[model samples]
Target: MTGRRKQGFILFRDVMHVILAIVIIVMVVFAFLSPNKYAIFFPLIFLLFSVSCLLDAIKYFKNEEHLKYSFIKATIMFILFLFMLLMSTIGFLNI
Candidate 1:
């Protein structure tokens, strides 16, 4: 890959790391902010979800899995990745 492409990929990877970590933190913050309805379940869910996404992402890199993989797996990973990314961005800016 070109230097620029390599750098972009690296940046994206780092961004995902931040997103994954922040998703858990944000959920915890919210859960504590309102333990009655949200409880710790939401944050714990986010944490578990992010871990799964990271694992799937790792699997893709290691095994060269492609679009042919199970749609559910791909969808879960993609949605979690995007959901955490969006929530993290909003949470970071709002708080």
Candidate 2:
């Protein structure tokens, strides 16, 4: 495990965090604006991201060497998981 690879991994996580935040904001806004079409798609995307985050967290945990930034990773994964649940609930209620 070279330093560059480790840095790349961290950067990738940061990128994923920003992308997920943007996605959630967009979906939430769209959900309110249309209150119809976005309601259908938001849950699907949220579920996908939540699954991805959970898998990534598993991988991070296995690599205990990077424990220093584990908190950030955990926070990001938790947010994704929560967002997924919220969106799913909203979708169910809308129906």
Q: Estimated TM-score per prediction? A: 0.41, 0.56
Q: Please report, in order, the local distance difference test score of every candidate based on alpha carbons.
A: 0.62, 0.71
Q: What TM-score quantifies how close candidate 2 is to the native fold?
A: 0.56
For model 2, give the 10-residue run with minimal summed lDDT.
Answer: 55-64
Which residue pairs clash within candidate 2? none
How would you encode candidate 1's per-residue C-alpha lDDT over 37-82 as one tens digit per residue? 7753564555456565765665455343355665556666767767
At residue 4, give the lDDT of candidate 2. 88
The segments of candidate 1 whose C-alpha lies over 4 angstroms from its true place after superposition are 39-44, 59-95
Highest-lDDT candidate: 2
> Residue 69 in model 1: shift from native, Å?
22
